[model samples]
Target chain A: MKTQHEVEQFLYRQAELLDSKQWQAWIDLFTDDGVYWMPPEPSHRTWEGMPAIFAEDKNLMRVRMGRVLHPDAWSQRPLWGTNHVVSNVVIVKSSTNEVQVRSRFHMMELRRDDVRHYAGAYTHRLKKTRGGYRIKLQRVDMTNAQAAYDYVLQVWV
Target chain B: MLQERIPDFSKFVEPDRVRKEVYTDAGVFEREMERIHETLWIYCGHESQVPKAGDYYAVQLGRQPMLMVRGPEGKVHVLYNRCPHRGNMMCGDRHGNTGEFFRCSYHAWTFHHDGRLRNIPMMESGYQGTRYGRDNPECSMKRAARVESYRGFVFASLAKDGPTLKEFLGASLVAFDDMCDRAPEGEVEIVPNCFRIIQHSNWKIFLENQLDALHPSVTHQSTGRAAHEVEKMIEKKTGKAPLSYHMLSAFATVTIDKWDNFQTINHPQGHCILTGYMGLRPKDPDTLKYEKTLIKAYGQKRMEEILGVNIHHVLIYPGLSVQSPLQQLRAVRPLGVDRTLTEIWHFRLKGAPEAIYRRSLAYYNLVNSPATVVNADDLENFWKCHQGLSSDGGDWVSFARHFGRDIEKDGVVESGPGMGTSEAPMRNQMKAWARYMGNGK
Candidate 1:
């Protein structure tokens, strides 16, 4: 079982990997079938039979990474770096090999004079693996989910 | 002299043309929020958005905060996002059920889904014989001047009087009809959550560009060209290019001159329709199954006719662009002369198969979502256009393309046959804008 400190450290590590442009490392944190989700609704969401607001298996995540890290991704030029501060961490529930954790994240990105701050919370459904732990699911719903956005969303919350 | 309500209206508007300041001036923008957006039957949302009792979706009416909520009786209501007592805004969250009714956080004033005052704390003592009693209309949350729903979409006008929603919509009603009629079940569910974009340019810029029929082949050329090359290479190696590539490649392969091939029909009150370009009725299994389901829902002949309705897009004047072929509609709310809020929403055709829904999702993500590269390119141009227009680079932005070339008959305007690159739409929209900003209602 992972302790609060251990989980916090892990979350920080994930942010560092993303901030450092360790694309492969960040990509490897998920289980083979892990799903990444971003609920588009600012309020209640019952998509009925539809899959999800955004449900991407490993393959879809890979496609996203390819587009983001691709040299031709002019949107990523100068490379925006983000600092993710995760707080209010809590272990909603824990089991033998799985844990559900909820935490708030405030991400600030800087590309020279341009800076954008994305404040949101995340719920991670994880499973204990032989090595450590693998993300089973990551669900993000931001405070500004309904706000009009600028450019492409090439970064993770 | 004209009524004092609209002073200087003559200088800002004309029958044939108007000053650019109408779009670039702050005062004019503010006046529009009052006289147009708030006074007209602006769209609220779709019925599917709030399917269950207590479900609600928040939206903007000009600069005011408003929401669309479904009551226990299954009726949709549009309400101001404010509390009646202390004036604290209700439903701080973008959307959610207020349970049976909305209870204000400041003073615990509760309101029903119909926006009727339900309870006020210590009602017996706090009110007594005061005008602040629960019976007072002021005690309850206020609704727009007029609220009505067409088919499933909701619209509200702040002015208590004017044309009815249907009357105002007129030919623009086709935006919703074309969308829901295409669905076999005769309804559509908004794909929950919209990609809202704040364009640095004026709201009019985005609206005009929607069916401009001239920018896609030029502004999106580079990205489209890149996608087209890959599509060709993939087609060479394999026998087919992924549908996603064609999604992007369409921008590149469809030349500016070829744009003239599509036809645009301009209706009264600024509504316009662009005839079909994308062939959605592929004889694939998913589409076939969806068609079969539609046939079951409606007769085969009706189903065939619905599916055969060749419409790629419908611009529902001043604020909306509906892509019926893809089951998506975008709403525009102007923030200022230079800032605009746009919500990009996709929909699920009721009774469609999972694969069919997924196809719409693919289009949503590939072309409509904020993550779309196509959007990235378009946003850049919008920003640049705003920058250019604000500068002294030029006083008049030309809507002269294909001018004096529109073929008008029976009160509708169409461009010369063969090319969609006609500026008839620009002229049509401007005509409406001028009328709205002029002396006439």
Candidate 2:
């Protein structure tokens, strides 16, 4: 069994990767069949038969990351500098080879002298592999998920 | 201050150029709300949105807060959200059932789903001879001037007299027909909620961009090129890439000159239609399965006819843009001179396979969603355009591309040969705007 300290360290490392815009490293943290999801509404319980802010499999994630990192992505021409702070970690469930962790995230993104605050709760289901623990599913429920947004949500929560 | 400074409408709009104030001036925006939006036939929610009786969806028509409700008699009614008693809004939530009647939280005034007065507290004793009475139409919730539905899509007009919804739709009714005809059951249901996005530009700017074919290659080139590279890699590695990649890659592969082949038909009422260019018919297993189902529901000949209707985007005058082929729609509501709210909704083809529905959903997510790379660039351009127009950077917005090349006959304009990149749609819209602004017919 992995100790709570070990799991917390792992979580912090993931946040560090995202904050540093380490796209390849962040992608490597996901399992072969991993899923990343952000529901359109807080009440949305499932991704099946409904729309999502983001419901990306590996291929879709690859496309998204490629677009964001591409030189010609004009929207990202002045790249966003983000700080992701993950806190209030709790182990929701644990099994012999898998665990589900819940955490609160406060992400502040700065672009072109404008700063936007994004707060969300993340539910991550991780599975222990031969190399290390990898994400099976990462579901982000943004506080303003259903509200009308002024601009595009360029990056993942 | 703005009223006196308001420029003459005729002087502001010409054949090839429009004054920037039409897009940036607060006075022009107010006049638009009063003259164009309030007088026109504005779209309400679909009937399927309120399938059950008493189900209601609150909407904004011009400056009025209204509710589209399914009455107990199974009829849809568009009524003002305000209660007649104290003018308190009856339905505060975006959508919900008010039981069989709408009850005011402030005054305990009860109304039927059709906006008739059902009951009021102490009415018999409190207003025995007062002006308030159940039979008086003024005492009940007010209704729109006209309410009509074209194939389950409801629209309401606030003006008492004008063209009927059909007359107004004219050739543009093809938008709904093309969508419903694709459904084996000849109807569609909304996919519950929609993505509500606020664009920091004039509503006209958003509408104009819908039929603008030249901007996609320039604005969305990054996303398209990225997808194309990945698509080629996947094809090299696995001998094939999914159809979704093609949807994105087409943006890059379809060069700017090729856009001229797809014609834009401009109608009299400011509505415009763009013919399809994307190859939606793939003979993949999923598509074949969907085609088989369609063939079974509709005979072979009818199925062929249904599938043969090629449409890319239909701009319905001042508000809606419908992509019938993909079952996607966007409704625009102007909030201010520089602020506009757009509701992006996608539909499911009834009696079609789940795979077909997934295709629509994929397009919705990959192309139209606020988080999408394609839409993000467009939003940035819209904001930049608004900022530039608001500044002294320019005075006139040009629509002179292929000017005087549009073939006009019976008040309908069609792009000339190899002129699909024409700005006829924008010019036609401004002409209609001028008429609606009480300048010209």
lDDT of 2 by residue, A9-119 (tens): 788888899888888789888997898899987787887767988887777777788888877777887657889899988999888899899999898889887888889
Sequence-dependent TM-score of model 1: 0.81
Off by over 4 Å in 2: A42-45, B1-7, B439-441
Instruction: Give model 2's DockQ, 2 decimals.
Output: 0.70
**Pairs in clash, predicted candidate 2:** none
Pick the TM-score winner: 2
Residue-level lDDT of model 2, residues B1-441, one tens digit each, is 655565579788999999999999898899899888888999988999998998999899888999999988899999999989888998889888889788899989898888889898999998899888887888889999999999999999999999999999989999999998889898998988789889889999998999898888888887788789889988999999878899998778889998888889999799999996567788889888878888999888998888888789899989999999889899898999999999889999898889888889988888777677688888889988998999998899999999999999999999888998999999999998987886333
Q: What is the alpha-carbon lDDT for the whole of candidate 1?
A: 0.77
Q: How well does each candidate reproduce the native contacts, as fnat? A: 0.26, 0.61
* Candidate whose DockQ is highest: 2
